[model samples]
Target: MSFASDNQSGASPAVLNALMQEFSRNGTSYGTDEATKRAEDKLRDVFDCDLVAYFVTSGTAANCLALSALGDPWGAVLCHHQAHLLRDESTAPEFLTNGMRLVPVAPFAARLDADAVAAQIAAMPDDRPHNIRPQVLSLAQSSENGQVYTPVEVRALCRVAHDAGLRVHMDGARFANAVAHLGCHPADISVRAGVDVLCLGATKNGAVAAEAVIFFDRTLAREFPERMKRSGHLLSKGRFLGTQFSAWLHDDHWLDLARHANEKAQALATALTSINGVRIAMPPEANEVFAVLPRQVCAQLGAAGIGFAEWYGDAILPDKIELEREILVRFVTSFASNETGVAAVTLAGGVLSR
Candidate 1:
């Protein structure tokens, strides 16, 4: 059983078929092809709003360029301390924004705490020439900690950001899963809730390498095309990226893929909770399950060839984890997860642990 990451999974059959069709045809370069237009139109229908969509190959490129569009080079983008931009992106934001600061705010379960967000913004005012102005607030839906933020929570954070004259951005690597888990309309947590831009991701769900930077507030996307083109992210063979997204969104395939993954995650969580001494790190809201596994249990799983990640971030409270004997671990389920296979593994472990 492999629960290492969704990135480890291959492209779904439907996405692959769509790509193969595009491979046989000749198309215009630089995102001017029919596939790119279709993908953008479908995305606008998904959100039920008029939006500017730019297809990019990677979420990192989508995030950095979108942030670069919203914030000035001398300004700052605020995000959770555990956010991908602040921790995982490796200074791409700094490079793309041309020296803008990535300020990490205190995190609540790997999410931005609106109160802390307000306080942090208050500390840096435009009136102070020496202080870096906060120009953007980026939130990771289905946060790095594997917790999903609800629409109400998103609206509150967005309200705080907008009140401070800062545009809000969402790192939506798991956006599909978040929507599936919440059973809410895609617009509820995005444009309707005041998000300025979203980095819509599909590669982590089922596509090969498809990501879209959607501008819900078109004003924020004024210079984004140049930013994307200059960064070498605007693919010349762009239809491949476009076709993947087009297929991913059609027939509600993206939601189906996400729902299956989420179902498997919940199944894994339920199975693990029955094991003696094993604790659910947080109630999983999406496709990721975090657990505090006893040391014996960890060794046993490893010996059995089950793969997972050892988590050490502040996503879970230290007091809740028994450092002396228990280890914090993350198990990520994907569209490729076989429910019966994973269930068998966890069920056997539960019996053995008891």
Candidate 2:
């Protein structure tokens, strides 16, 4: 019944079963195990391309290690102002890159516009001696405000970054949701869109704790293993991570789980729209629903033990919009969410409105 976050939902049954099966088997330590190889193969097949995949325990490690590889200590990684890497990671990216700065750019609907990115880059100081050069452009696939970026948009941004001598990285913590919503191959929007590196997340959608830092550009990833090891992100018993990915990617289960979450989010968003004094703050993309609710309704939902969070960084709202007696909140649906939970929240909102 929790609409707090997709991570609040536990691992998918398939992933958990795979973990149990791998627990009893003997395999090599580190990432050299056969299971790890199989997981890499599965990912290659899923992406429809040959690329390098490194499994890590958390999205933070994956993103930090990937960015560290793409940028130098004196470089900057440009991204949306509301991105998790900029707002939530707590300087891990800077720490991993030894001093790389995260430069916030123009954020529209929580997505970075290519023109805006170009303008931001163009406005940076050209004094290489004293200014940090923009090295990497990091885009969140399903942005923090629950908005998804289309393939064309991603390609345009990548082109802008690459033409400016900046490598592109995608913080794909909710990549499956974006892919499922787009109904396109994962490679089409990311690898083929000229993304140099991708932090593919599995923990939020269905896995217990598995995240992959995928390198579409081989050159950018040549020394990533060293970076991962130095950052202590290399798990000794790596088969556990492999097993989870193997099961999650098997038969396209990852997309199915994401599709379910996305569908639930849509349902919740639709329900909220029918309530008076409630307004959807952003497009209900992926598994997150952002909405502005009356203060009384928010208090009622909170008192009823319904799980959600107060979202403060909504970029979609106009500056002139009145917020005197209302607040923006985010409701996240996961593979485990169902009609019952969604209905409960909406029904409460309706009752509270009366």
Candidate 3:
């Protein structure tokens, strides 16, 4: 049983088949391929907007490129301290934005409220020569701690960011999962919610290695192709990237995959909740569940060969070795995470109790 990460899961059959089909026909190279254009059109249709969606190789590229569109070298991108751009990407946002600084705002879990972002921008000394001007506010949809910001929350943050003369960028790496959990229209958390740019993720959902950089403001994406090229994220066989997104978006397959993953996570959460000494750490809003498990139970589960992460957190009761001290563990369910895998972990928990 593997609860490692959604990225560890294999691609969906649909996406694989689409990739094969693209390989079958002779197509143009780069992003001018027919499949690439089709996928771009599909994204515009899906989002119900005229903005162009550029296919990229990974979510990092999408986010970095999107940020590049919003920032100048002297500008700063404000994001939650725990955001992927801040921690995971290892300063790719900075590299892509041409040496722009990333000024992390408050919220340890990367869930930023609108006012906090605005307050920071307001506090910045714009007249200072050395001070980096705040240009964009990047918020992760389903934040680092597996908590999702509601559509209303997104709107509020966007409003605040824009009013402070900053564009809004959504790190939508887990966006499909968030939308599935909330049961809202995609636009509700995107353009309608005032997002200037969205990094539409596909790799984690079901695609092999694909992500899209969608700019709601067409003007911002004008020079993005150059930025993507310079960052080495522009794939030579661009149709491969397009094919996956095409299959993912076709007939709402992306939503289907994400919803299945979220449902499995819910099932896992329910099972964990029923076990003694197993407490949920911040209820899951997406496919990720954070649970607190007893040391014995954790050892028991690990011994049984279930794969998961012991997330980083301060030990509340370090000396209580045998007691049920809180240990935050991240359990991520993916499209391929079947009932058998879920049962394996939950049943192991039961066995540990016995």
Candidate 4:
């Protein structure tokens, strides 16, 4: 009955089964096992390119370590103000980069365009010795506001960043959802779009905890192993992380799970908007639905044990929408989400509205 977050959901059956199978076996440690190799190979096959893929236990570790490699100590990484790296990661990027600054760029709907990035870079002081030089542009696929960046948009942003001598990194914690929403291949929106590195996340999708830091430009990944070790992110039982991803990617299981979650979110958004005094704050682009409901209705939903969260960020609200007595809420669906839970929430809202 919880719509609070995909993170609250349990691992998918496929992922759990893989973990169980791997737990019974003895394998080499520290990413030297066959399972770890298979997982990296799976990522290469999916991306359709030769890449350096390193597995880690969390999105924060993947992003921080990857950004550490992309940015220098005196450089700046440009990203949307509401990006997870900026708002949620608790300064891990700065700490991992040994004081590389994170420059916030304002972009509508959490999608950063080339112009916005270029302007941010231009605004920095010309005196390189006194001001941090912008060196990386970080984009969030299926952004914090749940808006997916199209391939063309990504390519344009990357071109701008590259022209300004900045590398591009994508925080792809919801990569599967974005690909499912776009109906495009992963490479189309990432590697081919000039993303230098991508933190491919699986924890929110289905795995217990698994994220991959993939470098499209292999040269950028050369130092990642040392970084992982130094940062205490290198797992001794690395096969645990590898097995989950290996199962998640096999037979396109990841996409199927993401599509199911996205469809459920669409259905939930439609139901929410149908209720009087309830309206969507932003488009339901991935597995997240952002809506504004009358305060009384929100209270009713809470009383009925329908779990959701009060959302506060840079979501673009509908014009002329009044929010004096309303609450902006977020509902997240996952591979384990069911129609019963969605229907229950909608039924509660409908009952309360009457």
C-alpha TM-score for every candidate: 0.96, 0.97, 0.94, 0.97
Error of 2 at 39 (Å): 0.7
Model 3 spans with C-alpha error above 4 angstroms = 107-110, 314-324
The residue-level lDDT of candidate 4 at 345 comes to 72
lDDT by residue (148-223, candidate 3, tens digit) is 8888999999998888788999999999998989999899999999999999889999998898888888998897
Model 2 misplacement above 4 A: 107-109, 318-321
Q: Per-residue CA lDDT of candidate 2, range 239-295, in tens?
A: 999999999999999999999999999999988887788888777879999888888
Off by over 4 Å in 4: 107-109
Residue-level lDDT tens digits of model 1 in 1-354: 789899999999999999999999999998899999999999999999999899998889999998888888889988887787887899899998898898888544456778999988887666657778999999998788887889999999999999989999999999999999999999999999999999999999999998999998788788777887898887899989989999999989999999999999988888877778778877899999998989888888888778899886456453566678989899999999986758766666766676
Q: Is candidate 1 or candidate 2 better by TM-score?
A: 2
Misplaced by over 4 Å in model 1 are 107-110, 125-127
Shift of residue 288 alpha carbon in model 4, Å: 0.7
- Lowest summed-lDDT stretch of 10 residues in model 1? 313-322
What's model 4's lDDT at 204? Answer: 95
For model 1, what is the alpha-carbon lDDT of residue 348?
66
The residue pairs in collision within model 3 are none
Instruction: Name the TM-score of candidate 4.
Output: 0.97
Which should have the higher lDDT, number 2 or number 3? Answer: 2
